[model samples]
Target: MTRETLDRQLHHIQDEILLLGSLVEQAMLNAVQSLKNRDRAAAHKIYQADQDINEKRFAIENAILILMATQQPMARDLRMLAAMLEVNTELERMGDYAKGIAKVTQRLGDVEIKIPIQEIEQMASIATSMLHRALGCFISENAMVASQIPAEDDQVDRLYEEIYRQIVHTMIENPDLIDHTNLLLWVAHNLERMADRVTNICERTVFINTGELLEMDTTDDEEELDSE
Candidate 1:
């Protein structure tokens, strides 16, 4: 295949990845909002939208195979194609996390929130914005902007920490709020994990674009439990 044709295909693949990012962002936002509004229908809608995310993921995988098989790109081009595959995997996981949040929302339908929704909402906001900015970084091949996303991820972690501390304090002091508060904690944990996955995608983009392997804090990394 001609280099021009291969490049065009890469661009198209990148666009599909960005489109998947948009879907994940929308799903996260809608899930959180549905929970806040106690609208199970809206929550289920977010779950239904995940079908599109899955379809787009299949399309991306096909693009990856075609690019790898036909183009036979070397070095940088190959890293980019591989990175796209990795990032899309993370995006699909984010989509699943969104659906998980939506399922929780659906279960809690019409149930008044016992714990505050502000932190998780904030976490979702930061995560969705990071997902968008990370996609922009991918399009522009801007490792700098991609590096900045880890800071936004810090916001998600801080919100998670704050939520955890608050819930612990409330549980110890109030006792009665346990069942309801535990569910909210789980929701916040999922949002926090999703945000961490966004950072992982950003790190992969930085590596793909710049060939620099930079380490960032990952709250979702389960090795910490073993270490502790």
Candidate 2:
């Protein structure tokens, strides 16, 4: 393929990745909203829509592989295509986390457990925002911006801990609600994990730009500072 044609195909694939990101972002937000509202129908819709996320993921994968095979992308272009592949996988996993939240909502049924809705919503909000910025950094090849996004995962972690403590306290107060409370904890865990995966996408952005595979761990940074 000519350079012009290759560039065009690359742009098309990037657009697909953005579309996939938007879908997963919506799924994450909708899943939590469904839980807050106790809307089983909405939760079920999110679960079913996971199939569409899966399909989009594979479609992006197929396109990338075809480009690699036919275009024989070299150096920076090859790194980019490879990073896109990884980002595509990470986005699909985030979609699964969303689906997992929806599943938890379904399992809760009609149980009247006291959910930490505010904290949970806050976690989702921060996570989706991180994801949005991560994708933007990826498209711009802005390693500087990508480097800063993972630090926001610290906020997600603190919220997850607060949610966990609240749930545990509630479970202890009412032993009978253990099962229902555990499901709520699972939802928080899903959101936390989704935010962690966004850091991985950020790592990919840095990789594509500098050819360096850095882990970007904020927790470790904190530990080092404390030791110093």
Candidate 3:
């Protein structure tokens, strides 16, 4: 294939990546909304939608592999394609986190317990926003913007911690609520993992740009410590 054709294929793959990102973002938000409303029907819909996300991820991976095998992308182009593979996997796993949240909602059926809905919603919002920006950095090949995105993960982490503490305190006040609170904790944990995966995507963005595979989460953690 000509270089022009190769470039066109790569752009098409990038657009697919963006589409997958949007789907995962919506899944995360919908999962949390279902939890807040105790909407089992909506949660089931999110769970079923994850199959589509998984299929889309594989489709993107297959396209990248075909390009790599047939076109033989070189240097930066090869790196970009490889990075796309990694980001695609990360996005799919984020979808699983959403599905997990949906499962948690289903499991909590008929169990009335106080949920830290506001804190959980904040976690989802921050995580999905980080994911959105990380994908933008990927498409633009902006290592600088990519590096800045992971730092926002600290916000998600803080919210997760608050949610955990609140849930534990409530459980202590009413031991009978232990089972229900544990399910809520799982939701927070899923959202936290989603944010962590966004950092992985940002790392891929940096790798695509500089050919340097840096552990962005560790760097962000060290920066946080230094600030303290």
| Most TM-score-accurate candidate | 2
TM-scores for every predicted model: 0.89, 0.95, 0.94
**Looking at model 3, how many pairs of residues clash?**
0
> Model 2 over residues 38-136: C-alpha lDDT tens digits?
999999999778999999999999999999999999989999999999999999999999999999889998887899999999999999999999999
Q: Write the per-residue lDDT of candidate 1 for residues 1-228, one digit (tens) a residue.
A: 558988999999998998899999999899888888878889889867999999999889998998899879887888888889988898998999888888887776565546668887888888888888888987777887788787777778779889888888877876876776677787888888887777777787788876876777645558757754
lDDT of model number 1: 0.83
In candidate 1 the C-alpha lDDT for residue 129 amounts to: 86
Off by over 4 Å in 3: 219-228
lDDT score, candidate 3: 0.92
What TM-score does model 1 achieve against the real structure? 0.89
Best by lDDT: 2
Query: What are the candidates' C-alpha RMSDs?
Result: 2.8, 2.8, 2.8
Q: Which lDDT values do the candidates have, in the order given?
A: 0.83, 0.93, 0.92
Model 2 / residue 228 / CA error / Å: 22
Candidate 1 regions exceeding 4 Å error are 169-177, 218-228
Residue-level lDDT of model 3, residues 141-219, one tens digit each, is: 9999889988898889889889988998999999997987898889999999998999998888899888999998864
